[model samples]
Target: MITLLLMMGTVSLSVAQVSESTLIRCASTEQDSLRISKNPALFKLRQQSEAVIQQYISRSRVNKRTNADEIVTIPVVVHVIHSEEGRSMGGAGNANITDAQVNSQIEVLNEDYSNTSGYKGFYTDSLGVDTGIRFKLVTIVRTYNSKSQFSPITDGDDLAEISPAWSTNRYLNIWVCRLNDRYLGTSQFPVVTEINNRTQGLATSEDEEQDALTDGVIIDFRYFGRNAEAITSRIYNLGRTTTHEVGHWLGLIHIWGDRNCGTDHCEDTPPAYTKNETTDIECTPVFSDCRGVNTRNMIENYMDYSPDACMSVFTNDQMERMHAVLELSPRRAKLVEFSKITTDELLVDIYPNPVQETLFSSIFTPNFEVFTVSVFNQRGQKVIQDKLNRTSLNVKNLPSGLYFYKVETASKTLTRKFYVR
Candidate 1:
């Protein structure tokens, strides 16, 4: 018994996984010497991406406002590029990614971005900033192939030549696939990439266009994603990997950047950095890298390197920067159109307001993905899926109630609500 208990107690972890309380204590202990270190690579790239994004912003007609005229709701399209090993067609698992996983991820973003998770320790007790960005998973699908051809057209269209790629101006296109050996996630002077990797497990936009890095995020599928139907395999399963990466995509930098010190250099965030260079988060509180100024590192900021649970705040300044990007960046303009594509903002409809069973609707897409429809609840849970071979659905036995229908194609999502009484 003693041996077993001791062994269990000895479970070890890296510095990244330190607890919030311990992170705070470590900051308290290293009150001095946590000087800022120059991570030239990170700094250079950050400047570059910012510059390119600015150029486009300057030229955009929407650059008139420094902040949003209103809280902008962006639609998201997740292209689940899986191995043939485990997809709807593959033997490995459902490979067809369930509506659960998709919905869970979206909910995570909404909660984190809204700053409503009840974790505000990183920022001063008095400071709080709300990033008015809300992402909704269109009850639609935008699946496409690398060629960007139409996908399950009965749903969307085959995403052929995703060139001019899905316009970033309206919709945020997130391609979740098996990483191509050639390119990890991509981000150019302004583009972003998010992918699952082996070594880093998960990583976000590293591009610093100015310094030659692309902007994006990556996650090891082993983390929040699974080849099987959706289920949270572990704590970090739906924790905040994408939230962290999306922060980068929105132009928020790592609070500590390449060094540690009093000021994270972002003026908006407190100064703090970890020199520990480790990634363990399962152990007791671990003291962090040296602390230069009395400033506490925003370890909880989604942008910080802390483990997903430890990081959780976005300051007003961060919001300003993101808002700046949205108003100025070319990709943001497409959001409205994306909303149209994914949510049927175009008003495409399915008859039978309350579907007792048979519900039929035409899914129209200017382009991308050949699709299939999946029914989901308000919680964004998938209730049913009708393959694309048929445009209409026979929802004969589903209990009558309100349900939202999603038409998924390789390139877009088209959704509308109906009744099933």
Candidate 2:
């Protein structure tokens, strides 16, 4: 057991595995501890990152800077590391899951994050809400390896090194492979202090390079997609494992804080205890001791260790926390800046492909008068719809992400893509 005195308190992390189909849920906490042990500077970096995140949240709340309606899209790259047996499909133990499984997991992420109605991730709880965050699968790379399973604790860096990442700052890289029976997945938490240091002239070349290499989420192949055929445990075949790990990638800790009756820092998330290595998959209400009072655990929360079927929501505060990370965190913030739309269409010229303050739209040839501009996020949600009486539009409030803008006149309509940084 490795004990570390975190800002919350002294947390002990045990690194061991009993089986692959039960008990152990995720080894993110243990993997984090291991990383910190290898690089002691990470301890201070995480502390600083948390402090900055808290401050950002506080200020945003006070100033009402929350982009509650803006949808931030993230580009994803899935690296499938598997053995020769993985090449075959339609089996209970196949490591290289099919493309359908990979796509199913993507659908699950969108459904859960947006809380699509009638989906498994939808809940009736008042605290549950649509996070307005979506993910786009940019690429999938399958590599055949001799190793059948990788250790979540020790082989994380090795796995990442083998397949490597697709520009960590631009994409959310997920490595899916066979993991030791103990863990379903692990995620590398984002460190913002190192990025902040770049502007403050406190970061070194070594810090930046290291962050680029080991900054992403990792998932066991079996627990990767929705009802993945290879997953032996029906309890976790719903693809929530990937959702849970992605939550960590977006700067969320376990609901229980990886300790007994601990705090996850989100005000809307009630205090709870760890559910690791437990067979309690029931959706029945569970309680934990918080300070002196008995508090009901939010087993339905994605950050909790509840089985895939039982977990369904992300609280409002949790949404804000994730959005804050997307807006301020280093690589996380950049993921939203990539636009899939092509820029070759000829109609009007949009100045400043990446506009931070104002976006100016100049028509090459004015075929008609009285034009209007409409901006839609990557999720096709129209965030800005207004008449373009003037050529310039104020986009200072749009959260950092890729967006499509449409300028419609009396006779013609033009659509193009733009970015907000």
Give the number of the best model, judged by TM-score.
2
- Backbone clash pairs for candidate 2 read 23-277
Model 2 ranges off by over 4 Å: 1-21, 117-124, 194-204, 339-421
What is the C-alpha local distance difference test score of each model? Answer: 0.45, 0.71
Per-residue error (Å), model 2, residue 273: 3.0
Q: What lDDT tens digits, residue by residue, belong to model 1 across residues 96-184?
A: 35566666677778888887766545363455566888887654343433221111101111111221123233345454432211111
The TM-score of candidate 2 is 0.73
RMSD in order of candidates: 17.1, 13.6
TM-scores for all candidates? 0.50, 0.73
Which residue ranges in model 1 land beyond 4 Å of their true spot?
Answer: 1-69, 89-95, 120-125, 139-165, 178-219, 225-235, 259-265, 275-292, 333-421
